[model samples]
Target: MQTLVLVAHPHLADSTTQQFFKASLPSTGVTYRALTAQETYDAAREQAALRQADRIIFQFPLYWYAAPASLAQWEAAVLTRTFVYGDHRYPLADKELGVVVTTGMPAQAFRRGGTENVTIDALMAPLAALAHRAHMTWLPTLAVHQFNYLDEAQKLQLVVDYQRYLTQPAPDTLANRQAWFADRLPAMVAQLAPADRATGELIVTTMTQQQDDLEALMATLAMIKEQDDD
Candidate 1:
């Protein structure tokens, strides 16, 4: 399936971290298009690209507790009722959707009483609604924090790492994901390339569907455990 990475960083040229990440992409089989250049937001281009993608990953730095303005603009202008919400013609209905965010603050800042005030889940509510309305499978969010603190070498490593993480297959379940991380962490940590480390530190945040499924699984297991105990 072709994965489309739609980026929305306002100042891509001045950005050391995001720029490097964009430049280092390998074409192989994946189709990539960057919309950072100052152009009149084209709905046709955006919708066409989206239609071609089997999986769509929105890559951006969180701006003012939400996605970049351009993304919001695209969403408003392009994702119309007939195309995205109302009719069966909603192109995104059966595809996969993922979010990749880079932030300046620590993870704690986005918590209940943390510096940023609102939690990540609360801030991402709009996207969640969009997923449900579109019937797209919402993958876990990939969030990278403290991008400004990383040195040049660290920044490079972050880019490479982010690419790998984005391309990695979605694990079947939370338990399976945890197991995969445990098995892969040692090697992933040791062989971390220069341009891949930034994305390496990213926290994969919640996907509502996955969370609900995990809760149900946990409740079932608890009941089984109680039966065994009895």
Candidate 2:
């Protein structure tokens, strides 16, 4: 899908998390617009870009529980009634809206009874509401928390997952996830030595079998529940 990423980080150059994350995005089928504090907001250009994209992503570092002022200004200038909700039709209707937010605090802290005292979902309600108002499908938010603390391996894994989030063709579902692993296992296993390849294959086979068994069990339970309802 054609994706447009509106980056709203005020200091994106200095932010390690955002820099790494931005670099991880796919090189094709994606466009990046970095909002700058000193730059003028071009509503016409922004609207045209949005029109061309199948997926619109607002990416920012969480500032005072929200996006930066630049983004807010962009929204105010671009999301006009005539453009977004004219008598003709909603321009963004049926498009997908997504959010990618980076937090300085730990992920665990952004939960009920935690230090932040609110879930990331709760924190991102405004963006969700924006999608609803614009008649767009709201994709799950990608929240990167405490990125400064992650080691090299963890950071690598995060980037890999982030790339998948941005580029994955299918929605987040168990079947799709299983298929992703199945598709990657062979290439991953090929890197292993001859003796280790057998072990890697066995692991993949076991995991696939377990997934199948779990799916079957869930189906049986669903059937039982349907009968009970009847």
Candidate 3:
């Protein structure tokens, strides 16, 4: 189950931040492929990667409130109905998909009524929906907001965090998070220390924050699809 990192920056040669992030990633058993050099998105390469991967990550900087042009083009050209749908509607089912993005604007700028007037999550709705339809587990987006403002130490920390975030197992989805924990309580019980067990209740309670986020996105996508259907 190889993890495929699909990098989609048009001008990788000129990108400092993205290049640094790419170079920092550990290559042990991980497949890193770029979608830039081919005269067009190569379906054979895309399918081969998909066939061999257990996780697929879309890494890019946001462009026009979305992914780089190459990513959008790859999606349009590679994710065909026959391969991604038709018989294999869930081509990547039970697999993981995440977006790793670097933004020029400060993190605070994306808050509601802030400079961008929308959150990062809002801006990434299309990818979230794509994850759902493809049946790939969607993870919390990893964002490098204000990549230019971070100091050397901070940049190093961000690199480690980004690497960890990309490699970690997919976060529990809202539709299944509670049920998953409930079923795992027996296994989790033996690991809980006396003092830790007392605090464990807080862990379950706080997970609702993640659930609220997933539910909101799912509901929003549902409405969007409904409008499209009409």
Candidate 4:
């Protein structure tokens, strides 16, 4: 998938969480744009990037219950009516729009009677509305709450989770997960150091067996369903 990550952070250089995410990005099939780093807005270029991306991610730290001002400005400048819907082209139709928002507080803080007194989803209503209007698929927001407090294991797990979020297909089913890893297994194994290459190959073989077993079970289930229908 062609993923576009638009980052809006006023002090990106100082943000450890943001830096970590940047380092964790997949090496291919993704484009990164820092909104604040740009000298000026280019509506046509921005729109072109959006059109080319199969999945677009708006990455930013929450500010006053919303994204940073640059994101809002970028939205205003690029999401013109003629481009989105005025001419009824719907260039973004069926594409996915996701958010990767980092919050200072814990997940629980963004709930009724909690510290923030509002859900993350509630704060992101405007962006969701935009996706709806454009007929694009609205992905569930990926919120990183209190990144500084996460343990090393959690951070390591986030690397894989975040990568999958960008490239893995929607519905997040087991079969899809298997297929995704399966597709990448060869390249992943090839990149392993010689000492570890054997282990990587073994993992690929094991996963392949598991996938075949899962497919066989699914086929049996489908046959049972058909029999019941008859």
Candidate 5:
């Protein structure tokens, strides 16, 4: 699946959070662009890119409960009525819309009694509404809270999590997670050094066994349930 990440930060060169995220992006099946890097946008061109993507992501830092001015500006110039819905083509329909927002505050702060006192979802209602208007599927937002506070392990985990968010199929389940890893394990093992390759191959073998065992157990349960229903 093709995924487009539109970054809306005014100073993309200086944001470590964004830089890290960019570094974590998979080499294939993903395209990224900084929306604010250019002075103006070509409405037709932007719409065409959006149409090509299976998943569209808006990545930015929140500014006063909304995306920065650049995002709004891009929306005004590119998201023309005729392109989105006026013609009734609904070009974005069946596509996925998602958000990746980085924040200075903690996750707990985005609650009724917390410091910000407003949930991230509430702040992002407009974008979700846009997805609804265009018949797009709105994905659950990926919120990064206080990036500077994360430790080494958390950062390592985020790499996998972010990659999955971009490429993994919807309704994230254990089976799907296994499938995603299994698909990449061969290439991943090939990239490792000779000394570490054995361990990588072992992990792949073990995971395959686990997957087969899990499937067998699930099929057994299904048969028992079917018999009970009879």
Candidate 6:
């Protein structure tokens, strides 16, 4: 699926979180548009980009509990009746709408009892409503909190997770997630040295064995239940 990432950052070049997140995405099937302070807004180009994408992601740093003015302007210019609504048609129908937001404070602060005193979902309600109005599917938001506090290992894992969020077909499902990793494991193992490749294969084998064993146990339980019913 084609993904269009619209980044609304006043100073995108300096943001560590946005840079890392953008770097994590694969080069193919993804388009990045950064709304910088100097660029003039082109409504036609923006509308064309939205029309081409199967998934549209709005990436931004949270400013005073909302996105920056650039995104609002883009919305006003592009999300008009001529392009998004009216005429008994919706250009964005069946498309996916996702948000990736970065926050200076900790994630815990977004909850009811915390500093922000509101859930992230609550804060993103306007975007969700926009998606609904546009006939787009509203995806779960990826919120990066206290980004400066994360260690190297944590950041690495975050990249992997964020990449999956952007590219995976069924990111929220365990079976699809396992399949996605399994599909990548072989190519990843091929890139390793001889000894590392051997170790990687061994790990994959062990995981496969465990999965088989669990499936067998489930089958046995089902048979036992069938006999009890008889």
* Per-residue lDDT of 5 in model 3: 86
The number of clashing residue pairs in model 2 is 0
What order do you get sorting by TM-score, best first? 5, 4, 6, 2, 3, 1
Q: Give the distance in Å from residue 137's predicted Cα in candidate 6 to where it truly belongs.
A: 0.7
Candidate 6's C-alpha runs over 4 A off are 205-230
In order, what lDDT does every prediction score?
A: 0.73, 0.85, 0.77, 0.92, 0.93, 0.85
Best by TM-score: 5
Model 2: residue 103 alpha-carbon error in angstroms: 0.6
- Model 5 C-alpha lDDT versus the unseen true structure: 0.93
| Candidate 5 Cα misplacement greater than 4 A, ranges | 215-230
Error of 3 at 86 (Å): 0.8
User: Local error of candidate 1 at 89, Å?
Assistant: 3.1
> For candidate 2, lDDT tens digit of each residue in 1-230?
79898899888899887788778887678898898877776789889999999999899989988989988888988888898878968989999998889889998899889998998889889989988888999989989888889999999898777766665655877667677667767888999999899999999889888998988887898899999994
User: Per-prediction TM-score, please?
Assistant: 0.68, 0.79, 0.71, 0.90, 0.91, 0.86
lDDT of 6 at 54: 91
Task: Itemize residue pairs with steric clashes in candidate 2.
Answer: none
Per-residue lDDT of model 3, residues 100-169, tens digit only:
8888998898998898989999998998988888787887888888777889999988866765655544
Q: Identify the runs in model 3 with alpha carbons over 4 angstroms from their true place.
A: 172-230
**lDDT of predicted model 4:** 0.92
lDDT per residue for candidate 4 within 163-225, as digits (tens), equals 888888986777888888798899989999999999999999998998889988988998999
- Once fitted onto the true fold, the runs of candidate 4 whose alpha carbons sit more than 4 angstroms away are 215-230
Ranking by lDDT: 5, 4, 2, 6, 3, 1
